[model samples]
Target: MSSNKNKYCLFVVVIGFLTTNSAYAQNYKKLDSILKTANNEIYSNPDNVIKIGEKVVKQAENNVDYKIKGYKLISDGYSAKRNYEKSLEYLIKSSQLLNLSKDKLLKINIINKTGIQYHQLKVYDKAIQYLDQAEELIAEYPYKDSVHTELGKNYLVRGFIYKEKLSCAIAITYLDRGIVELMKVKDVANSSSKISIAVYNKGNCYLLMKNNKLALENFKKAATIAREINAKSLEAFALKGSAKVLFLEGNYKEALEALNKALSLSVGVNDLILNQEIYRGLAENYLALSQWSQFEIYQLKFLETQKLIKDTERTSVSESLGVKEAELKAKKIELSNKFYYLLLILILILILIVLFFYVLVKRKTNEIKIIKDKIYLLQNQKVKEL
Candidate 1:
């Protein structure tokens, strides 16, 4: 199969790079050891991730051409642990290291990483600016196929952020555009089937926009490609996205089936975040169908996701921004409370209007009854006199 050949070719390329660049191989060993230690420390005590990250940054500070990769590893570890500020700090250091990049290719790669850092910061403008620059620089240079793959990644990230922000319309457009660009370089895509998943995420963006027809077309393509590449996680991601589309389209039975398949696959991969989303979706669908038992069960499962990722501290106003989200969770909760209060007020006004009408009718009935009784008594007196 062409897909298999592609994989073989990518493997040869990477092996050739490794074999040719003994220096990179040597650096990989050192970085690998530090990565292991850093990961272990992070798992046992996440507070250490930030500290270790700081140490890594400090070690790189004096040397103008220090290994930016060390700080990046620390940042990723901290970000995974939900320590955003420290992660953010190291990300900045990684970007600053770009100044020492004598190699044009390295400069482009660092720009891409800086773009990512800005995106996480919710400075989408700066993120896009850096990404644009990276794209321009990539076109101007001669590097491995990985350079174009990185450009594709930047577009994918931008699309993802827009989708997360509920700018689904724009997200779909960008995702489609990114997929087109990636396909043009597919023969050279050499980025493995990461390109396939990038396309997979584009389908996901379309689903979020409620375009089931378009979403279905892309999701199927992504799944087949994933299968060809033996990438089960990406397949599950596509399955999950497709299931969501089915649920939104009122195809609950099929959606439930797809969700079950997705959850089974996602569980084996130990992706707690995806599991949380699956349970949440299941709960929503069950609630709509008035399946109270299933709703309650899945709602609990959704809430349990809070236990997997570390909860960030909330002290200083800015540092308390743990999730790198532009909006606070509390703000959403506050808005919901306001909406419910407004609804309550409307219900109370309706009740008062009904009570007023009932009192007026009762008073008129009493007045009419008294007058009728008086008139009947007067007529009886007149008949007695006759």
Candidate 2:
């Protein structure tokens, strides 16, 4: 009977162990689901994206990958909303978590993304810093196509940064290296587009150096590749480069035609950067043609558009911050509830341990008492016999 009772108690313990662990597994699955959902909707529904990210972050404990992924999701959402400060906060968290991961490629990719974000915020030096770090890391990697492609992007962005600083010679060198690397990427779709961008930037660098012949050649090559790949944005950008060359050559009529075509393409793609460039191109073309009224109109339009873009970005950032405060408060409460649940589980395990010990001690005591009774009866029998 005692043996049967012990077996039943052991079975209960096993069941409790499985139940507790199963709950933990289910909780982790839920957190993963929330993270995936947030990723899919990050740009389309930025507010909900952050809310889901916060949920995953709060629920995740001691899981490095989950925490890092959650932080990334939140950062991406903030970035899409133009909340660069908040986005940088979460990106920093993600980078810190990289210490817990063993994947070198993921680390490099995150570093690259950080560089791009800094570039968008116009922190040009910091952008170069991170991109430089990515390049250094990728150097140790074997010469795979993917690695080459990433290196191309790093060099391309760095070249643009140099261009902004008006170091045309240095920019051209970087752009040349970028184009070379991209050309090594085995004819993939992404590689094709990157090659177009790299070459286009190279053309701009050449233009800055007053080398119109080479600039025109590179721009035409970029446009041909962009058209073949159906990358309309890049095509528009390449066309603008060509138009700039035409403007510098004093072909105002031809420059106006190319600029008009690029303007329509830029508007169709809704690329604000390209649109700004188009407006500037039109303003310059008109100025060169001695059309003062047209020049003035386009120049004013460019300034107005620039202001509008800034205003829209600021409004998005402000709105995201307002939404985030409320969501963060809710997440804190949810995290508290999770802590309580963990505490409850610990208490239950402690109770189970105490019950196990009590049962063990009581069983030993009963056995000892039975042995003592046997000794007493044996002594009485011996005395009676004597």
Report RMSD for candidate 2. Answer: 17.3
Cand. 2 Cα-lDDT? 0.80
lDDT of 1 by residue, 1-386 (tens): 99999999999999998886786556555655665566444322445555665565555545433456667667765654445567777767777776766767767767777686667666677678888888888888875565666676677777877877758777767666666667666543233354666667777766666677988877777777766655555566677677778777898877787677777666444545567778888888888788999999999988877454334333212543553344467778889999999999999999999999899999999989999999999999999999
Clashes of 1: 0
Candidate 2 stretches with Cα past 4 Å from truth are 1-101, 142-145, 287-297, 309-386
Q: Give the TM-score of each candidate.
A: 0.56, 0.57
Top lDDT model = 2
Candidate lDDT values, in order: 0.68, 0.80
- In candidate 1 the C-alpha lDDT for residue 133 amounts to 89
Residue 26 displacement (Å), model 1? 6.4
Candidate 2: residue 368 lDDT (0-100):
96
> If candidate 1 were superposed on the true structure by all CA atoms, what would the RMSD be?
25.7
